[model samples]
Target chain A: DVKVTQSSRYLVKRTGEKVFLECVQDMDHENMFWYRQDPGLGLRLIYFSYDVKMKEKGDIPEGYSVSREKKERFSLILESASTNQTSMYLCASTLRGGQGPKEQYFGPGTRLTVT
Target chain B: DQQVKQNSPSLSVQEGRISILNCDYTNSMFDYFLWYKKYPAEGPTFLISISSIKDKNEDGRFTVFLNKSAKHLSLHIVPSQPGDSAVYFCAAMTSGSARQLTFGSGTQLTVLP
Candidate 1:
């Protein structure tokens, strides 16, 4: 089974504070993604890395950045956390050319609260 | 601006009955569709999917139906159990270089005994 682990399950941060959320995949997937799940907004992609040092912005990437120094780890950084940024964050990984929808495996998730 | 939409926010169904979840999309370019099931405090898991060439796909009690002409899709779960209760998300992706998916808000299903 593919195991995707997040650095923290729950986190609390103050406004204007820098926050880092880490994700690691044991399957060595080539694609890693960060998404924010919000009510009435589903899962919107924040950023994705196809390979080490390669990143692409998704639908809502503002105020967020990503780092992929290694293939197994992906990190999401909040430049300055704000109340509006409080939400559940999810990390997912998938093989590059796998069959059938390239199904993504995800970590448990990190619920971030920005006060 | 929401390409994929699941209008129903919640649904309640009796156990051992059918639970049908609906999804709609505005983009004709989307060629692939997927459904994901999410539990509390967990990320969404891949449930089922259908390609543009096929209309229906079934796995065990979970079946997915797609209507290309209507730009709509539906998931049918027969004899839904209490354990099946969760938030279901509908997602779509166009056939292109980037496989960034567009997802619906999601529908929460509650199965009552």
Candidate 2:
């Protein structure tokens, strides 16, 4: 079974602080994604990396950035945390072979609270 | 506007009954659809998916139906159990290089035992 591990299950941060959420995938998939899940908004992509040191912004990537120093790990960085950024963060990975829609595996998710 | 929408917020079904979850999308460019089941404090898991080339895909007790003409899709769970209670999200992706996915708000389904 493939395992996507998130470093923190729960985190609390103050406004204007820098926050980092780390995700690691044991499957060594080529595609990695970061998404924020909120009630009534579902999951919106923040950033994604197809390979190490390569990053691309998704629909909602305004105040967030990503770092992928290694193929197995991806990190989401909140430049300045705000109350609005408080939400559940999810990390996902997928195999590179499929054309359009392939299977996507996800991590346990990190619930971040900004005060 | 929300590209992917699950109008029904919640649905309740008794044990052994059938539960249907619905979703809609406005983009004609969307060629792929997927359903994900999520439990409290957990991430959404890949339930099933179907491409526009096919209308229906079934696995065990779960089935997903897609209607391209109406731009709608539905997921049916027969013999619903209490363990099946969770939030279901419908997602769509355009057929392009990026394959970026757009997700619905989600519908919460509760199976009463």
Candidate 3:
């Protein structure tokens, strides 16, 4: 089974504080992604990394940044947490290319609250 | 503009009955569609998927039907149990697009006993 684990299930941070959310996948997938889920907005991609040390901005990458130092781990960083940045963050990984569909496996999710 | 749309915000169905969740997409380039189930405080899980070449794909009690001409798809769960109650999201992606998926605003499903 493919397992994706997040660093924190719930977190509370003060405004202007830096927040870091970690994710590790055991499946050794080459592609990793960060997404935030909001009410009525669904899941919007924040950032994605296709390989180590490579990152691409997603639709909602204004307030968030990502890091991929290693293949199996990806991290999301909030330079300065704000109330509007509080949301459920999710991490997912998938194989780069294969014969079948590229289905992403997601982590449990981290709920961050900026106070 | 929302590329994918789930018209129904919520759906209620009695146990042992069929529950249908609908989704529509505006992008004609999308060739792959997927359905995901998410519970409160948890990330979405892959449920089923269908390609543009095929109209339907089934896995156990969950079946996803795709209509390329209409740019629409539906997920059918027969005899839905209480455990099936969750938010269902429909996602679409084009092949060779770095595997980025465009998801719809999910539909909350409630299964009543």
Best by TM-score: 3
lDDT of 1: 0.93
Per-residue error (Å), model 1, residue B94? 2.3
Estimated TM-score per prediction?
0.97, 0.97, 0.98
Kindly give the stretch of ten consecutive residues in candidate 1 chain A with the minimal lDDT sum: A95-104
How big a share of the true inter-chain contacts is recovered in candidate 3? 0.57
Per-residue CA lDDT of model 1 for B18-107, tens digit only, reads: 999999999998888999999999988999999989999999999999999999999999979999999999999775535667889999
Encode model 3's per-residue lDDT on B1-113: one tens digit a residue: 99999999999999999999999999999999999999998889999999999999999999999988898999999989999999999999999877999999999999999
Indicate whether candidate 1 or candidate 2 has the larger TM-score.
1
Docking class of 3: medium
lDDT of 2 by residue, A1-115 (tens): 8899999999999999999999999997988999999988899999988889999998899999999999999999999999999999999998665686976789999999999
A best-first ranking of the candidates according to their DockQ comes to 3, 2, 1
- Kindly report the interface RMSD of candidate 2, rounded to 1 decimal: 1.4
B12: Cα error in model 2, Å: 0.8
lDDT of 3 by residue, A27-63 (tens): 9899999999998989999999999999999999997
lDDT of 1 at B27: 95
TM-score of 2: 0.97
B15-88 in candidate 2: lDDT tens per residue?
A: 99999999999999889999999999888899999999889999999999999999999999998999999999
How displaced is residue B32 in candidate 1, in Å?
A: 1.4
